[model samples]
Target: MSASHYHICSRNIGKPVEIRTRDGRVHRGIIHRVDNRMVYLRPLPQRNYGGYGYGWGWWCGFGWGVALGAIVGLALLPWFFW
Candidate 1:
């Protein structure tokens, strides 16, 4: 499971993705980086916090890490929005 998560996260580096974890939490962000056990996601704005383009580039700091094993689903989005 983690192997596939690693594969998917690695493949989508720098691309936008929506990840669902076993904990029932959903994360929408750019695939920042991946490691042996974690996928870092640079989260987009939720509503009015930062909006689109807030941390949309490489200049943005590294995102929080989510354990690969905790991830149950992953998908790439066509575009980013609030």
Candidate 2:
């Protein structure tokens, strides 16, 4: 990730974001928290449950909804550099 990526995450705290990591996995959720190393994501309520309401929520480290890269905020325009 670039420095601007962290900048975007910092500016749009507490907003919805979609993150695509280097592994090709995509995570969609709200921005629970952001720091120098990682960006925590709180997954949507409906997507959290599997069948009988047995599923995990947001995590800190290597798990669901936790992405390490440039985060795209759903409610904001993509950052552009000229």
TM-score of each: 0.76, 0.56
- Extract clashing residue pairs from model 2: none
Total clashes in model 1, counting residue pairs 3 or more apart in sequence or in different chains: 0
lDDT of 1 by residue, 1-82 (tens): 8898899889989888889999999988888889998999887644444656635344448578889999999988876444
- In the order shown, the candidates' Cα RMSDs to the true structure are 4.1, 8.0
Per-model clash counts, in order, read 0, 0
**Collision pairs in model 1:** none
List candidate 2 stretches off by more than 4 Å.
47-82
Ten consecutive residues with minimal summed lDDT in candidate 1? 51-60
CA deviation > 4 Å runs, candidate 1: 45-59, 80-82
